[model samples]
Target: WSPYKLLTVFTFIFQTASKDGEVRLVGGQSSHEGRVEIYYGGQWGTVCDDNWDISDAKVVCRSLGYSDAVTVLLKAAYGAGSGPIMMDEVACTGNEASLMFCRSNGWRRNDCHHSEDAGVICKPNEDESGSEVEGTTHVLDRSMDFAESLKNLYETRQFCDFNISVKTNGKESETSIICTHRIILLLNVDANFMVKDGAENFTLTVDEECTPYVDDFIRYLYIKKISVTLKSSKCIHKLASMYGILELQEFCSQLFTQLLPEDLSFQNQLSLYSYALSTQDTMLADSCLQYLAWNCKAFAESEAWYQLTWDQLGNFLFRSDIVVPDEFFLLEALESWILKKGPNSPDLDKALIQMIRFPMMHPEQLFQLQFNFTLYKSHQDLFQMKTLEALEFHTVGFQNLNQYVDLSNIDYMPRIYTSPTWSYLLSGSSIYNQYNPYYRYDYQNFYSQLRSYSSSFHTPKHTSFLFQSDMIQWSFAYYESAQSCRNSGRYCYYDNYPVLLLSFESRPSSNYSIQYQNKALMICKDSYVSDIRDFKNNLVVLPSNDTSSYTFPCSSNFSYQYVVRPLYYSEFQNTQ
Candidate 1:
């Protein structure tokens, strides 16, 4: 059978079979795949392929102790079987443990012929030495657990060739001396330990604060398992690094990423983030930053935000994915951070404040920030240039932005503002197909407005273009055309032909309304030619009062490579 057919068979059986039923593969080339047969009521019978699918196949495969089903097969792909077609129209939801639990026609009451038998191909066992035969059992050997066996040796002190004396200042006890293998320590734990010819004694010294983590670190070398709690993960990670156990260090990093966000408060997040940075754990640090950025609004209100150092606050403001109601919220958060920093030099304060993307802020926000903020008020001369730069970006018509301002700067890029001031960046792509002589393919991608107000509040919307909502219908479609060939002997003229259509229709009585100015800065970028920062063109969208809909005229040769962002009132002000 073809690979596709085999895969279909696997899925159908896994989803269709029952755990309580005795199932077996009859005609597969390997034990993991074949015609499915189930023993029901003291007789074996084949299943009918009525509504058989991948989900049905999954249950069958998993019931047989296989990992998963590769595909579902139908119409007796493995050849017709004898005996009754016991179960027909078997419907499995894939989560069912066995085919016996699935909804199906009464057993032995199928309206199917033997040729309509259902089959499946399951994911083969990773160990392909040979499939274990049915009706056979083998005893497992306890010595196979190498880590446990090694641990047993360590506990028994059967072959101790080295003694490690841990010193915790004046806190050392008899338990501080650990007997271990010299080669295991030299190979896995720490390779830097200098072995003095025949000297069997070794003394390792660590601060009292890290003494608690030493036992776990030493035990991990024998068992290959780390026992670290939230409070001790950092110390254990440090101990592991000191002992040259890179695997343990990585384990602690991942543990921190998982625990810091869920169990502890934002203070722990900040503390762990700082520790991760100090330890140069980029993965852990990045995870912490993402958590903070996604919850910037909440984090800003926490005591940790007020306690953040100037550098830490700058680190957050520099990120383009910081989630907040608007740039004004960011300004307020920065004001609080600055006030907490106490009195500082105007130059130093201004340098940190420069990280804000003022261009993304509303004109009103910029005006208030310029005149009302204490820092801006006290040092107007220092911030005057920033205020003017933002004002220019807002007032410059969307069409004139490239000519008047440096669009490549970070300030020009929009952050993920929850307010309707900006829509999530919309993306879709199309590729040229040369297989067919005359080809035209239509690609439709859906996206909604006002993404920040979705019910899934804490989830980050920076990377999502499709706003989660059912009240409003929002979508964009583009057609990729290779009509130049037109089946005219394949030597026709070649050119890029593409068209874009954008639509938005809100349901009647929809509670959604556009706040602030109705006009939006619809910036378009052709990703084929430039990065997201480089704009191919721009459009001013003013949804009509009756329909709340708008469309853009096709820009030839580049519509297929579109990455459009509709900046709400905040992106560009009414310069007129």
Candidate 2:
């Protein structure tokens, strides 16, 4: 026979007859149950579940020193194996000393995949209500003998003939040298070790950054476990990727997927976010972005925030989901980024400046930007136009601006504002009785009273309110009802049931409501939150009155916020 065929035959015989062959459970919840695998042919491999039963499980459990087979688990109950399917159609008579002694299709001769890998759950010795004491003791003794033999073999370096050295480069390079057995290297390391003319020694070079984690990687080859924390996950994953350890890389990916932003410090969060972007780990990157969005003030001062590229900064600002204590912080952060970038590209700067939601800023905030802000002074013409648009949005209510401006503009939309000036109101799902056969006049009211505003209400009843803006007084009424097509002299309505209607009238205290005083005033429907962002069109901005009252259409499961901020418009205009 050829040398390769002879070697295969010798391996088959040794695996079937050698008393020194080892067995272990892997990927189990506990030690007593998992996929059944045997150590032979200088490697570990799974057993096929063909014709596998409790009798076969008994022999496997006896070999492992377990009391008895609790049950035979088939089709890889614990987890699928990744190695070769070594044994198949194992038949045990429940009297064999070991699974090795049982009949099988033969080693490495199975027509099976890892999906068919077998598993077992063995009864613990603690359950001894009525058990065989002497037989169990004998099995335990044999297991101890096998363990002792392996320990002795490992310590004495028996059959070991290869030397492997791992080194990391630095100013003073550190090296780890191992006198390894040929079988250990071939089984644990990689398939490259399976050589015809066995080289006496092998050397591997590692990156200096991965030096600390290299030992842990080496230990995993022997113990099959490694410690991973947020701090070490990156390094260990890097080492695993470098060595093409796909299983270890998969484990690290799972760890990253389960991570939350609060699981790491802010600095570590930023570092991991950058790492996730580089590695294309979208889940982890999104979690970090959520944390950053909520903690806008904290991220604004962070060194990492300053280090973001212009594209990164622009993308972050473009997100409409960013919720801060106030929108002014966003403007300030952008200003800081602009100053850091210098005055090289005015076109790029203009593109980024348009991302600012100037209409969302408080009136006082806009006043400060138009006058006191240095960036605004540097680009007076651009900011002056933006400031004028925001001023128009404040002076003319959104409903009035619908004729002149495209309300679909993102600048006209409001993010979730959680400041004191903004008030949130949610209508319960149970409150609406719309388009129901047995519809009644039943309604639920949500009333929110704040310092600047008295009450915001959601009710089906048609209610009119007479309120004064800090500048002028206005009267408005809004209600929801089921209506059919009708002609009312001026216009015809064709839409059917469930419509919200509003009527507005301006009653100015003075003849000149449009006169620009030192202070500008407008009521903003800050945000309308529903499954769809289109709910924003329903926002009814009620001017500030002594007893300000605002009403919403009584629809199920909807929320909105409105804020009234002090608007300041200066009398002096800076000459460009």
User: Each prediction's Cα lDDT score?
Assistant: 0.58, 0.54
lDDT per residue (tens digit) for residues 1-576 in model 1: 332332243332112233226788888877788888987766788988979999989999998889899999998999989865667779888977577666564455444667888999998777643555555344343332455556766777766777878887675663367787766565552433534465677676776777877777777776666568877888888776665566567667656645544522488888878877887777567767766775677788878888677677777778865666776788788877888879988777887778877766666677676567887877677568887887776555544555556555667666656554343333332223322333234465533121101010112112112222223333333222333223322232222222223334332242221211111222223311111111211211111121101111112222222222334223334311
Error of 2 at 370 (Å): 1.4
What is the per-residue lDDT of model 2 for residues 1-576, given as tens digits with 9 covering 90 to 100?
332332343332112333324778998866688999887656688888989999999988988888799998887787888755667779988877667656664455444557778999888767443444444321113433433443444455556566667787663356777555565546555324432266678776676776677666655654355789866777777666656665566557545533433332357656667876776655446555655554456677767677777766776777655655566777888888888767748878777788888876656677888666677876788888888887777667534555677655667555545454432332222123322233234346543221111123221110001112233322211123222112112232312112222221333343221221110111122222211111112222221121111111112333233322222112232111
Model 2 stretches astray by more than 4 angstroms: 1-165, 171-174, 177-205, 218-224, 241-265, 274-284, 302-304, 340-344, 362-364, 385-413, 423-576
TM-score of each: 0.50, 0.41
lDDT of 1 at 231: 76
Winner by lDDT? 1
Worst 10 residues of 2 by lDDT: 458-467
Q: Estimate candidate 2's alpha-carbon lDDT, on a 0 to 1 scale.
A: 0.54
The CA lDDT at 83 in model 1 is: 68
Flag clash pairs in model 2: none
lDDT of 2 at 5: 38
